[model samples]
Target: MPPAHAVTWRNGFKSAFWIANVLELFERFAFYGSKAVLAVYLANTIGLGAQTAGSLAGLYSGLIFSLPIIAGTFVDRYGFRRTLMACFAMFSLGYFLIGLGGMSAGQGLVQALGKTGYITSVLVLTAIGGSLIKPCIVGTVAKTSHPDVKALGYSIYYTLVNFGGAVGPILALQVREGLGIEYVLVMSSLVSLLLLLGTFLFFKEPEVEPIGGNPRTLGQVFRDMLLVFGNFRFISFLVIFSGFWIMFWQIFYSFPFYVTDVLQFPRFELMETIDAWTIILVGVPMTALVKKWRPITAMTLGFALASFSWLIVAGSPTVMAAIVGIALFAFGEATQAPRFYEYVAGLAPKDQVGTFMGFAFLPVAIGSFVGGPLGGWLVQHYLRDTMNPAMMWYIVAAVGFVSTALMLLYNKFFAPREAS
Candidate 1:
C-alpha cells in the first residue's frame, strides 16, 4: 500500500515534472548564457586573446565539475528543497555580479572594499559558484522521483536538460548579438529569478526521503564514496569512458576558435550555434529510435558517431559543413547520456543505489578537467598549423573511436554484467 502523499505525487508527476522542465529551461539559459558568449566576451570585451580566453573558460568549466563532489553532500544534508532554494538564489547573485560589467563592478568594489586588483578574480569565482547549481539540482530531481517511474522521470529530466542546453544558448546568442554580452548576463539573471520563484512555490521534497542504512554522518558519506574505488569495475568504466568526453568537448572548447581563425566562416559563431539547434530538432527523434539498444552498446555507438562528426569539418571546410559536424556530435551526446546512467543505476551495489549513483558523475568531472586544456592546446598548436588545422579535430575523433572500442572491450571482459 502506498502512502497517501506518494499517491498524490504520482497522480501529479506530469504536472510536477512540467514545472521542473520550465525551471530547467531557465537554469540552462543562465548556464549557456555565459558559455554562448564566454569566449567572445573574453577576447573582444575583456581583452584576453583567444587561447587565454579558452583557457580561462576551461578553468571555469573544470571548477563546475570539481566543486560538486563536496557540494552534493551539503545539498543532501541541508535537504534537497532547501539546497535547491539556495542554489537558485545563489545563482542569481552570481549572474548579477558577472553581468554588472568589469568596469562597473570594479568601481563599486574599489569604493567599498578599497581594491580593484581582485575584481577579475572575484568574477571568476562567482562564475564557479554558478557552475555548481546544475548537478546539485539534477541530483535532487533524481533523489525525489520514485523507483518504478524513476526511469521515466529522469528521461523527462534529461530531456529538459538537453532542452535547456539548446534553448539557453540560442536565446543568449541572440541577445548577445542584439544588445551585448551584458544583456545576456541580465537575461540570465532574470531567468534565474524565474527558477528561484518556481522552485520556492512549486517544488517539494520527494515523498520518500533518501533511505539508506541508518542515516549517514557527513564523514560516513565521504567514507562510502571512498569505498566505491574498491569496486574495480566501476572505477575502470569511469577511467575508460573519459576519452569520449576528451573528444566530445572539443566542439565547445575548440570549434569556435577554429571557425573564426582558420575556416573563415562568415559568422564564426555560427559553427558553435549549430550545436544547440541540432539538439533541439533531432534529440528526441534519435533518442526514440535508439531506445531499444543496449546501454553499453549505445555508448559505443555514441562515441563512434562523435569521432566521425569531426570529419565533416575536415572534409569540406565550410560553415555548413561545420553545422553537419555539430549535428554529428549532438547525436553522440544524445545516445551517451541515457545509456550511461542506465548502466550506472542497474549496476549499483545490491543495497547502495544512492551512494553508487553519486559516483556516476565521476567520469564527467574528470573528463571536463582533462578535456578543456587538451582541446585548447590542440587548437592552439596543431590546428593553428595550416596543413594540420583540421587534423586537430581528427585527433579528437580518434579519441572517441578508440574510447568506443575500449568500452566494448571493458564490457566483454571486466564489466559487472555478461554481454548480451
Candidate 2:
C-alpha cells in the first residue's frame, strides 16, 4: 500500500463505498427524523404521559444501540447485503406500523394490543432493524476503501451521519407542520422501503478477506462478550462515561416537553437540529484545535463545557439561550467524542483491540437505557409539579460536573500510567 498522503481520495474507493454511504445517509435520515418527534408524538398524539413516553422512547433507542453487539455476529454470519435487506424490510414494516398506530383508521390494532403495547412492540422491531445498519455500513466501508484512505473513508462516513442528523429534524419539523406528525413515521417508512429496493438493486457485497482468518461463531462472540465484561477497569470507564450520553440524550428525551409544555414552542423539532449542525459546521476546526491534547484532557474539558452549557439555559430560559446552550454542548461533543475512540483503543489489550472497540458502544446503550426514564422524571417533577423547570437543567449539569470530576480522579489514580 502507498503512503496515505500520496493516495488520491477519488482512486482509493470502490463503487460499493459510495453506494453504502448513500444508503447509510438515508438510514440515518429515517432514524433521526422519526426520533425527533417520537417523544412529542407519544405524549400529544398517542396520549401517553410524559414519563411513559420518555420510557418508551428510551427503550427503543436503547435497543437500537445495544442490539448491535449481538447483531454484528449475524451480519458476519450472513453477508452485509443480505443483512441490510432484512434490516430495511423490518424498518419499513415497523415504522409503518408505528405511524399507523397514531391514526384513527389504525385504531383496531392499537386497541387490540393497547396503545403502549402496540408502539412498544413495533419500536422493538424497528430497533432490531436499526441495529443491523451500523456494522454493515461500517464493514462495507472497511472492505471497499483502500488501506491508505481508510481514515478518510471513515471521516466521510462520519460526515454523512452528522449531515443526516442535522437535516432529519428539519424534515420532521416540516412534516409535522405540513402533513401531521403521524406522517413523519410514514415518511421514514417510505424512505426505508426505497432503501430496501436500493440495497437489492445497487448494493453488492464487498469482497474482502475475513478478519482473524474466518468469521467467529455465535459462541465465540458470546465468549468475547464475557472476556470484555471481566475487564473491571474498562467496564468502570464505560459506566462513568455513560453520564455524558445521559446528559446528551436530554435533547431528545426531555427538551420537547420543555419546549412545548413550558415555553409554548410548537417547533421544538427544529431546535433539535442545532446540535448536529454545530457538529457539522465546527467539527473540523474543533478537531484541529484539540487534536494535540491528551485524550483524557480533551475529554475532561469537553465534559466540563457540556456540563456548563445546561447552566446557560437554566440561568436564562429563552429560545436564544436554548440555541446557544445546544451549540455549546455540540462543541463539547465534537471535542471529546473522536478522542473517545482513540482512548478506548489505547486502553485495550493488543490482541483484544477489535473486541474492546466493539464493546465501546456500551456507554451509549447504558446512557440511553438510563437517561430516558431519568429525563422523563425530571420533566414530570421539576416542570410539572414543582413549577421550577430551571432546576432540571441544574441537575443535569451537576451530573456532567460529577462525571467530569470522576474522569479527573480516574486519570490521576486508576488510569494506566501511560494513558494518564
Candidate 3:
C-alpha cells in the first residue's frame, strides 16, 4: 500500500507538484503582467506608430509562445531543475532590460536609436527570454505528475495560469498608473527570482519509466525533434492547429485593444470580471464536463462560438454586450483548452511524449508571431474608424470560421485513431 498520505514537502511527490504549480503562477504573472499593458505602453510610452507598436508587441508576444522548441531541447538535456534555474536567471535579465528600456524609450534626447528602432530591439530581447520560460515550466510540471493524475494536473496548471493572467493585469494597472509600466517589468523579474529559488531548492525528478529507445540527452532532443518531424501526418496536424491558435490567440491579442479602443472597459475591470468568476469557478466545472467531450469537437465548437461572439461585440458595443461576448469567449475557452493537450498526449507514440508536447505548443508561438501585425493592421485600419467596426469583427470572425472548418475536417477526415 502507498505510504500514509502526507501533505508535507517531505512527501517528495506532493512537494514537487505544488512547487511546480506555484512557480507556474509566478511565471504567468510575469507574462500576463507584460501582456496587460504591452500594446498601450508601446504606442504611448515608446512612441511607435499604432501599426508599428501593435506589430512589435504581437511579435514579442508570439515569441513567448513560439521559442519553446529550441529551449525545450536544451532543457531536456540538462534536466528540468537546471533548465528552470537557467530560465529564471535569463528571464530576470530580460525583464530588467525591458524595464530599463521602457524607462528610456520615449524620453527626449534619446533618439540616437531612432526611438522606434530602439524600443523594438528591446521588445525583441524581452521576447527571447519570455519564450524560454514556457515549455520549461510546463515540462517540469509534466515530469512531476504520475500518469493517472497527469490529466488533472495540467488542468489545474492551466487554471492557475489563467488565474495569474486575471490578476497580473489588475496589479499592473495600479503600478502602471501610479509609478509606470517600467515597474511591471521589474515586478516580473522579482517574482521570477522567487520561482528560481523555489526550483533550485525543492524540485526533484519524478520516477518515470525509461523510454524503449535510449533517451536523447540535450543535444539529442534537438536532433530527435527534426527526425521526428519526418512524419508527414504529425507536421500536417501541427500546421493545421497553428491556424486554430491564430484564432484562439485573438482573445489576448485583439480583445484588449477592442475593449479599450471601442468597447472601453473601466480601468482593470475587464480582467477582474474574468478572474473573479470564470477562472475561479467555471474553470474546474467546465473542464470536468469537457473531459467526456471529444477534443476536436470542442475545438470546433469553441472556434465557431468565439467567432460569433466577436460579431456580437462588434455589432452591439454596449457594456452588457461586451460582458456577454467576453463571457461566451471565456466559457468556450474553458470547454476547449483541457482537451487540446489531451488530444496531443493521446496521439503521441508514448516513447516520445515530451517531444510531442513540446511540438504542440509551437502554434501558440506562431499565431502570436503572426497575429500581432495582422491584428494591429485590422484594428488600426478597420476598427478605429467606428464606421468600419463590423469589418473588424468580420475579419476576426473569418479567422475563427476557417479554424472551425479545419476542425471539422480533422474530425471527419484527418483525426488520429484511438489507442487500444
Candidate 4:
C-alpha cells in the first residue's frame, strides 16, 4: 500500500519514540523551569554573595551535564524504565526540598544544616536526577528509531528539547512573578511527578541491540574511558571547545544579577527564553545552510559571533542592546552546536562512538565548573566594585575569541593528521 522505497510515518516510528519524547519534554520542563530562577534564588533568598552563588550553580549544572559520561553504562545495565523511574522520583524530591529550603518553619534543621549546606544538598539531588534522565531518553530514541529514519528521529528529539527549554523559562518567570519563587519549585516538583506517573502507565522497553554491542562491564567501562583519555588530540580539542560553554553559561550564572541589580532590566529571564526560541526558530535553517562547511569553520564562526554578541550588551546597557546581543548570541549558538556534535562523531573510531560521544559532554561540564566562578568573579570585581559593569562583557568576549582562535589552530595543525 505504501510508496516503494519509502516508509510511512506510522511505520517508521514506534510508539516508544513519542512516549520517550513526551517524557523528555516534561523532564526538561522541570529542569529548565527550576534553572530559570536558581541563581536569583541563591543570591537573594539565601543571602549568598554573587560569586558563591555562581560557583554553586556551576557545580550543580556541571555535574548534571558531565555525570552522563558514566551514567549511560548504568542505564544499559539497569534498563531505561527503572532508571527513568528513579530519576523522576529524585527530581520530585529534589524540587520539593529546594522549595522547602526557603521555608522559615524548619528552624532546627535550618540551623543544623546551614543555608548553603541545605541548598547544596538540594542541588546535588537535582543534578544527579538530571544526569540520569538525559541518557535514558536519548538512548531510548536511539533504540526505538528505525535506522532509515534515525536522523529524522534525532531532529525531532532536539526540536522537542528546544521547545521545552523555551517554554520552561516563560512558565517559570510567570509563576515566580505571579505567586512566588517557592511556588516555582513546587511547580517543578509537580511536573516531575506527572512524568513519573506517565512513565509508570505508558512507557515500554524498546527492542534494541546491547549498547555498543554487549554492554561493557564496570571495569571495561573504566578501561574504555582510560583509552579515550589517552588520545591527546581529542582531549585538547575538548578543553578548547569548553571555553565556549564558559562564555555560554554566563547567561544563567551571572546575567540575572547583572541585569536586575545593575542594568535594571525588569524581566531578565527573558534572555534565556529568547535563547531557546531562537534555537527553535533558526536551528534547522542555519544548520541546513552550513551543512556543507567543515566542522572547524562552523565552530570557529560560531565562537566568534557569540563572543562579539556580548559587546552589544557591554556597549549599551539599554533593553534594545540586550535584545540584539542575545539574538546574535543565539545565532552563534545555532551555528556551532550541531557542527560540534558532528566533529565529535567524526573523531570517534568505529568501535568507540558511544565512548567518544559520552566524552562530548566533558567540555560542557568543564565550562560550567570553571565558568561559574569566572562569571561570579567578573560581576563581583567589575560590576559590584568598580561600577564598570560593561567591563565584564569585554572579558567574556575576549574568552570567546580566544576559544575561536584555539579551534582554528587545532583545525590547521591537528586536523591534517586525519586527512594524511
Which candidate should be chosen as best, given TM-score against the real structure? Answer: 2
Residues 178-276, candidate 2, lDDT per residue (tens digit)?
A: 999999999999999999999999999899775676677788888988999999888888889999999989999998888877777889988888999
lDDT per residue (tens digit) for residues 1-420 in model 4: 767767755677889889999999888887888888887887777667778888899999999998887777789888999899889999999888887776676546656898888888888988898889888988888888888888888888989889888889888989889988877888999999999999999999878654456775778768878988998877888899898999889988888877787778767778778788988899989999889987877888889999999999899987778778988999999999878877877766767787777788799999999988998788788877778888889999999999888888887788544421
lDDT against the true structure, each candidate = 0.68, 0.90, 0.69, 0.84
Instruction: Give candidate 4's TM-score.
Output: 0.95
- Evaluate model 1: give its lDDT: 0.68
Number of the candidate with higher lDDT, 1 or 2: 2
How many residue pairs clash in each candidate at the backbone level?
0, 0, 2, 0
Q: Candidate 2 has what TM-score?
A: 0.97
Report residue 168 deviation for candidate 3 (angstroms).
0.9
Model 1 misplaced stretches (Cα beyond 4 Å): 1-10, 14-17, 100-124, 131-136, 139-150, 197-216, 230-232, 266-270, 280-285, 344-354, 382-388, 417-420
Runs off by more than 4 Å, candidate 3: 1-14, 104-110, 142-152, 194-219, 227-232, 266-280, 342-357, 383-387, 416-420
lDDT of 1 at 135: 54
> What's model 3's lDDT at 282?
79
Top-down TM-score ranking: 2, 4, 3, 1
Predicted candidate 1 versus true structure: per-residue lDDT over 4-50, tens digit per residue? 66634456354445565667767876787667666666555655555
Quote each prediction's TM-score: 0.81, 0.97, 0.83, 0.95
